[model samples]
Target: MLRRPQGNLSYVSGVTDDPLRFVTLSQALDETVAAHGTRAAAIFSSEREVMSWKELQRQSDDVAAALLGLGLQRGDRIGMCSANRREWLLAQFGAARIGAVLVNLNPAYRSTELEFALNKVRCRVLILARSTAAGNHLGMLRVLAPELDQPGAKPVLESRRLPHLRHVIVLGEGLVPARAERFSDFLRRGSANGKRRLAALAAALDPDDAVSLQFTGGTTGAPKAVALSHFSIVNNARFAARAMQVGEGDKLCIAGPLHQSLGLVLGVLTCVTTGATMVFPGPDFDPLRTLDAVSRHRCTVLHGGPALFQALLDHPELPEYDTSSLRTGIVAGAPCPADMLERAVQLLCLDELTVVYGMTEAGPVTFQTDVDDPLELRVATVGRVHPNIEVKIVDPDDRIVPVGRLGELCVRGYSVMRGYWEDAKRTRDAFDETGWMRTGDLATLDADGYCRIVGRVRDRVLRGNRLVCPEAVEALIRRHPKVQDAQVFGVPEVKPEGRSDAKPEGNRGEDLCAWIVLAPGAAASAEEIRAFCRAKGEAEQVPGPVRFVAAFPVTASGKAQKFAMRASMVREMKAREIKTA
Candidate 1:
């Protein structure tokens, strides 16, 4: 039902006659359990465990009762800092059941980022793994809250740095610090009275109540906590589930981290609405583990970013396992190259692999390709807007651009987030006066309503007098047979001596740089890549300096960190200049 009423204008709306479900996530889970009690609700492949809908309900109920017994009340903020695990899922639903807002903390975050997030949201309780690849999370907590290490420390945390934090729950079998509670013991503390209270709280919960605080990718600045209400995410998941044609029989292998909206909202919530089986390949993304999960569980759906799929396709043991069970999936969180999409379709057997375009603020999904869409549409554009959403491409002056014209994408609909947590100024700045949430993504709307994302507005590289779109350049570079992936960005050009007319510090022009990850067993020089781009066309499109890399820096959600790449390149260039001088 996507339509462009005025063919000359860039405004489009996804019209749907179906009424949106107005229920809390707790209510949604209850309905699904009633309908599919015996069906498998979750499968932790790494742990060799499976839980049916009925079992899932019982475990989540235990989690809710435990939190209630700890004196957590409605609207209290509880933080979860861990990789994908059964406990993370339980905490997500449990907090929602008691109307507590779960603040998703990235497991990759270090002490500085972690401290800021907890204090910013005023988290009363935090649940974390003992350790991760990042480091010892429990150790970091001790550093931040030295009171935890004091003699005769009580279970309640008292830290001057993190004043709002009162309780710390550690996951893992071991002797926890004196001020922390073990997850096992914490879960066992639930009482019959607590269970009754949980039920009463769930019954009184409203669909509009905020259920989770998902942090943004923070590519531009400090990560903002985006508050999402049950009404927003549930409907968003329902629309996405409908688009993917997910059902109770389908098993989904989720490679994305549960801390992000991609995992919790799209992956988990979508399954809750459709009764599909949710599969966690492992705590962190491992191609081998993911493939084994798909082959072993016969997972019908898969979800991850472009980098994840690229790793799977490039794995040496790819042919050793069967991926034919992957009939449908979602490739999002970054710009997807056409070559990568084609490879996923042929190698992973994801014929219905869709491309989703959204940010954390848009309930994580605003536009998504349909299952039956053409390969070209799925590869080239993030398809039409989701039902009950409105989209428009606007110029700098806020005028709607014409179809086929590039402009900033803006959206307004039920799926948009309430706002950044406790940041009124940022929330006000995120939308227009009329309530349209500015996406900050440069994109073009086709006559058919397909959206081709150009790149980030700030990510455009200005070389000489021309502005270069890094996404376009990266797409061209990825077509090289020797290249597996490419990230293109602007590096500040060193100012020549006595150049008084040079642009100011922030506005200085930049030279195009390309960081390429070579295809396995393939070798190529920087000059060869430049020559390849030169032969293709457009001298302006060719990158000035090409550097080979094993991989590009990426966020937890798997989006390439172009700003980080740009800064690193600038530093390298400056060092070179100093050595030459």
Candidate 2:
């Protein structure tokens, strides 16, 4: 249901792109950097080399010059496998500034995952981050080097590991192996001291040009390459800053991994656009280290995933740290149990906490809860869409659903991505023929125009000829006092005792499976939980038995992967059936 807004496109800022068509991400970056003198921006860190805005600007310039000097063209892919160090951001912004498509390589990715991503995108230059205490990154890259450079496998010059990877840059304080070049060496060769050849590299890039190939962490199998033009991400940052009310001199602490879209735009680019100071914990986020950074930086904002915030709250020594500086930022990825929100506001003493709703392709968009919203309302909704973004609820017949009814949430606007890189078929499938991106989410828009998510349409169960939403169980479980977090999914009914055995186990069709993380020291049995749900029961609402876990498996983006849980539950059921007499 589209709400009648007090304002329309005129309410948006810095989004006046070419009126004739859509602009890309590269175009936006060029404009933003030029707007703020490159010499004026800086990324602070604890390391020996603290980069000034000028140094960062010239370094990116030299990096882009080095990249271009290698003859990599506009459409060529440069894959990066690094953690959240300053160099990672430099490589990313540098590549984007050069009009070369930057692929954010996940450090958490094993060689198998990296192999799939690299080969899929024909990446020409590979950047690797050295190992850190959080994980062994460089070791993993070395193992995969053979597949990447080993020669004769492709039409490139010679046999090398990662055959398609012509150049590999390491961002670490270690000696480069015979196979790869250190980022320092590359920069040194590209330029002497602070001088830069920015003219050719800084040519006005088109808004529609391909700027990045971010991989979508598919809930099913291997991740797919999600393409974002300069405009898609830049516009998202521009609108998001307005949505969050970010201003100059604001201090931001980034807790989410920069590799993902939520982190990239909100954590990285938002600071760039607003002239905000961003303080990042070393490569991987450490809960203890994060608290330290907050205390020292006197952080004004904290944009974190639910997992990071939960872990912070769960820490036995939480009271020892100084968290009084936090004020406003986004909290999402996992469902923020209403209790977490209260603790954040009362304990962390934050001024505002917004729950963002969107994935990589769409950027960090669709809905955002207002900072001043009440606790329950904040817990229940992802809020309203920004001015430049358009959303609709459509039924199976492609008609828009009535207000307050659940339907597939679709988005159409500047934040929508161009398409999947090199995969037109998936790109076509992702959007309706008319161009609205199918969000695969089941949500209802209230009379007030705020949308409350009902469930993920992709996670629905076909129960006795009707679709049952698992999110109903999630909402119900969260209502319990002891339950800290809940994620629900359906297990397809198996023909117990074989298809020929008859009577199909009770005829309710499919069963619901819920994973619950309880509050510390609290204990509740399944029967008691079932009683709670039964008390709140409504017609046709399929409430499932709750399963307790110390912690749930999650993605890099901090989202619970229910598909894995579903598969594991199937195996557990099969084993139970075998053990029964």
Candidate 3:
């Protein structure tokens, strides 16, 4: 009984007249603390650390003072290369206090990716963890800039490679390199006088100033730096807080990496803007840990991608966990598959599970389902346009398509990012003449204003929530001596069920597949190629299955037809009919 609109226009604006307050993140934090100082602000369950609003304010002030003592100034880029932890939150709010842009570095990034992020943003101060489960972060940093490990190293690293970097502040206690300062010592250097100065600095700050930079996977090449302002993210977080009906003492469990917008903006800032307690299950997403944290903290809300929710539901001990406290949660970054949403509602105690849709360029989210909406709407669509935002579905000719017609989705609002940092050409190309940010997602708007994302118009691969650029991975693979040419694409995969009677489950997710034209007579196995990619690239970027191809199907323009490759792989896999179940 769906009705279709008669008009040719396909634009829609959010109906709410909710005021978007203009305030810096530091100001927002101050206001929250003033209102709820005694309330719990953050809890790191794994570390057994808890902080009230007052404690968080004091620690963040000290961290800001330490950064100022390190000679960082307003508008300076400060990079945080660590996983989720108490210190990460400290750096996040601390940088906001002084107007320093906090650059989010993915924890999974290797030496090459780390080098690119550090140098690309011209990070003056770099904050990092000693190491992560993946590998030694400091060791990799030394590999990128070996000057740190060498004797008689200058107090300030004089690397021609990273000329803008002036100081390295290592987080947590460990063997501190002589070239870097320990986080504890750095914090001790801050005095009472510096805290007084921080007040004046906060007073002079403007909401429009660029306060953070997030890297997004590129369509043309490597990832680009997305610059966002305090104004943009604050308003987005406020809208989200309102949407989720967040309130004081409402514990929110977060399992995603803090580097992503989901964790930092939606999870952290939403709690700060509202008066909710931010809970971190662990440094990374662990289904059991997340469930445990929710049960122990009596968390009312949880936020993560679909994969995490699925993992939680699929856990063998799911029935044993007391998740009755969970009333609402957000499942984003991927589609909520068949039966998954219902299962989440029934088993996880998430009766008000909502689905959100957005990209990094749009300050993360512009569409989300209401808590009271029907389960069908919550799973089938990305919900209506958010308040204070405008959306349109346009044809290739820049004209608005009729409702229910598939077209590229474009958005216009305060939530839109300022621009890609320092890339004028790309920035200009991202927006239309009328200032609409082209989202590159093919979608259709129904007469009721609900949007259904169909597919992507751009040539990119999405493995879970991670945006993987085939060209970027291909470029890395091509560097192999035996690989003459390479193309990476997403191939639909199926996972075998453990039971003999169960049918093989279609993952509805993708696996990275690489088709390479090897050098004459060169032979390579899938393991060898994966290992090579693992050493040189990110684990996510490494192809799961390697195929040796003599040549690729190309169009008349000599462009590799990735769609053809995907189709061929799908057909080949289906023909094998391996007993995955």
Candidate 4:
């Protein structure tokens, strides 16, 4: 329930009878294992691997012991770059078991991104897959650290580029680098003595200790590392599990990337807290495999972003599989359209589908609709504040706004991140004077405390003195009969003929561009969409350019990359200018 202390102010706190859990992740996992030892903890459908709770506990202990054998200490950072797989979970829990922080590195990252993240966090150890559907992850590491190519090099890597990176553990069967150790060999390094050390470390672990570093989506700039504590994520998962009504025997098919908090905290940790079965459809999200897993395993819950759900809904072979087993799930990582939610309910049999709103910094979830909420409430709003969380909407001056007025969303509570990892300046800027973490999202709160996200503050486009919100435009465009999906962003304004690059008195220096993905067998021109938007939306909300594409460039977690789209549009505009000259 939401409590409003200041009448008409956009401030609300979630009041719940359930108290927050004070245990570390390792303790939470142990408690679940004690109760559901023989139950299936995880099932990798594509790999044909199933691990019971007892087995998961045993393997994670071995992982912890191996890290101890390698001379890793508490508060050290261990990076893992891989797709969704069993090793990901093993490494996650293993790192927590020894009080080490796990830095989740996206498998899609190349040399530059990978190097920056590892060096930023000062990672001492990295565990990565040899390859993924994205590309050769190991090859990128080799390019970043040429020392790995040297024959007869020691197990510890010594590189100038990645100075803090001392060890690289590679998974999958391949020609292992001389300086890098194979994952299987690394696990064997665990012994009875190392196990004793791991047990001792686990016993001394604190719930407030940082256990994970999640990088932001980097849509606007370089990604900031958000540090999360054991207490924050463990309680977050427990509360989320309660909201979805997850139980011990429930099976969840989680398709989001493990690098993001959506997958690791909400998907993996939720299962650990609830004693539910975590099901992976494949190493990476495959709609066919997901459908098959839901039918084959009778998965009770499903989780994915809007794009993933759309892929599943639009797949040609969707009707061939049974999705009736799916009852509840989360639609997050991007703004979800009402039509998509309705379609998912009718087609995917997700009667209790809820929309969640959060960022990587807020332990990944601050607001989520209840499973029993009406369809209109579920589709229109991101729901009320999460349990044990305080939320408020503030204007530019950081003053609280009136209810139902648009402003920046600020959050404070146990679920808020400890801070941006090791960056004091950014961390200081993330919160207000009273310690409310600024969420950087434009939103409005109703009297009932339901939050309606308008868009990101940085995402608003300035065009000829008029500010246009892309989310509003995109929502209007998606209502068109021919459009299946749409992403709106701002590109550099093309100067009129005979005008210089200098900004004129009234110029805003940006133009709105819309990328549209048409419905199957649908054909529409750019003018058609612009006209439709002009008819239904305000003048400032109508995009100038509309480009129809098969799909939008998205992050691994399925959020549309508006920055990438803007870059592509700018490049095309430059090409056109050169041609005209």
**Count of backbone clashes for each model?**
0, 21, 0, 0
lDDT of each: 0.89, 0.71, 0.83, 0.89
lDDT by residue (438-529, candidate 1, tens digit) is 98899999888898889888888877788788888988898899997898888886655545565665786787899999989999998899
Query: Model 4: per-residue lDDT, tens digit, 84-147?
Result: 9888888999999999999999888868889999999999999999999999988888899989
Candidate 3 structure quality by residue, lDDT tens digits, 86-198: 88888998999998999998867767778888999899988888887657888887777777755554446656677888778888887776677778887986877778899
Clash list (residue pairs), candidate 4: none
- Number of clashing pairs, model 2? 21
In model 1, pairs of residues that clash are: none
Give, for candidate 3, the lowest lDDT window spanning 10 residues.
495-504
**Candidate 3 runs further than 4 Å off:** 1-8, 151-155, 459-581
Model 2: residues >4 Å from true position, as ranges?
1-40, 43-45, 48-50, 147-161, 191-197, 316-324, 374-376, 478-486, 494-508, 515-529, 536-558, 571-581
Cα-based RMSD of the predictions, in order?
2.8, 4.6, 11.8, 2.8
lDDT of 2 by residue, 462-523 (tens): 76677878777778877889988788888856544434553445663676777889988999
